[model samples]
Target: MSIDAPYATLDPDRVLDAVTACGLWPDGRLLALNSYENRVWQVGLEETSPVIAKFYRPHRWSDAAILEEHAFAQELAEAEIPVVAPLPFGGRTLLHHDGFRYALTPRRGGRAPSLESTEQLEWLGRLIARIHSIGARQPFEHRGRLDRATLIAKPMQAVLSSTLLPSSLHAAYRAAAERVDRAVADRFEAVGPIRQLRLHGDCHPGNVLWTDAGPHFVDLDDARMGPAVQDLWMLANDEKAMSALLDGYQQMRDFDFGELALMPALRAMRQLHYAGWIAERWHDPAFPAAFPFAGEARWWEQHIADLHELSEELT
Candidate 1:
């Protein structure tokens, strides 16, 4: 599909047709479509058996990343991590349809548990540690350190250059952005070498599914070779959430105290990046309501508050 093509509206019949074409479904009823960066359809066939057909938007993701994800999923499956392995179709990791790339995997049954609960929070932390443990021993090339400078400068540059954000938010966003930039720099300067490992770039609670066995991470699309702390930082932004997750990780592997101490600043950088992205995409009607211009403004306000709090500690 064209990079500028409108978002595709998934219909049950169309999903079934696509599944039938892939030979995974002679006949089935589409249960639900999980529409996000990609489009996934839950298909129910005979005997309560279900599978998911995922259509990848080439415009949204680089071909390299998509293919790498397929390989990564395969490797994770081999390591006996509970994951939905992609099925081969037409000898390709993706199926081309109307200029969009698509793939399929059987749906793993599970519900997303609340991160608010102590038990669930602990479970999440341990699961992340296991993923990191498995990732640690794997032979993957490192994508050099995503240092404080790059993380801060990139979003600030983007937000400043983009005309998407309103003038009302311009000052607040820039101020918050600068504060975080300085905070990250100061924190990293005092810290030792930060270790890089294969990381699940987006490790928010939503990305993990709690199953009978344990939490199974989906959307390995964001997986990359970067600082392991990037994953931890994302999950640890919320104090309660991080405490729970850390409890779990400590059970499985060791965590660097310095890195844990530096998490607040790292997490602030992450939130800043996301705020910039949201501001840049605000004009789009399909942009998530949760991240509207007002939301971005509020985030910057809160971010500045956090930055002040961190700055006080640093001083």
Candidate 2:
């Protein structure tokens, strides 16, 4: 199988078969979920609630790392936190079917939480704090970290190698990236020592599902070690929203205000990382289909402009 087209052979049959192997009979209804790094599906079952089956991206994470994520989610769920944890089949959460590693989770349904809602923001903040409390108990043995090198340098490299980035803009892109890199490093150094714990590394409104029961946290795929603010910033769009979030967070856990300074750096890093990810994954057909704008040279120009703006904002 080609590394670029990792999902080439993952047809509907394979998806259903993987689910059936988990001792669950599929009702032939398969719906693809909105995921790129990993393939996810909502598989209806025989007279039972549907299950969310996740097929991990090829070579992205090791068995140990994936298990750690599963264990963390299970821990959160066991603590009465609303986390969508893997449903262990025959005492194993991670299962294999024809070279594809997959796991079954109960299909959870909810609309995107309104980050604009102060009540929801505070509520989500408290839940995030609880997640961090559990996350602090121990560090991940095999998972990744949310740092400059891991998030910035590597993604920048990927962006550099992408053919999608026009050669004409190469020099400008590199210069902007370098400036952003230095600024991120300076910000990290300025922040001094940080208290990093396992975090929901990609904490945004989209990852949170809002229902009457409040919120349900899904997709811990990007879970990593980082400061508490990494989980808070994406959910709070403004200063007032951040204050509300912090108010709720402080009710459950003490938040270091110093980490707020890292927000600009984080935002810049995210921007770079997103571009890098799209570049690296452009080999996959789904990326091109989903991000048609990226194929245009104009988009790269805009991306370069944004990077420069981020660099200036940080500096």
**Cα lDDT for residue 18, candidate 1:** 70
Clashing residue pairs in candidate 1 are: 1-99
Error of 2 at 222 (Å): 0.3
lDDT of 1 at 176: 63
Clashing pairs in 2: none
Query: Each candidate's lDDT (Cα)?
Result: 0.66, 0.92
Worst 10 residues of 2 by lDDT: 113-122
Q: Number of the top candidate by TM-score?
A: 2
Q: Mind sharing the TM-score for model 2?
A: 0.99
Q: Where does model 1 exceed 4 Å of error?
A: 6-17, 26-28, 31-34, 46-48, 114-122, 138-151, 161-163, 168-172, 233-244, 288-315
Across 97-120, the per-residue lDDT of candidate 1 in tens digits comes to 545567878777678767668788
- Please write out the lDDT profile of model 2 over residues 157-256, one tens digit for every residue: 9988889989998999999899999999999999999998999899888889988888999999999999999999998889999999998998999999
TM-score of each: 0.78, 0.99
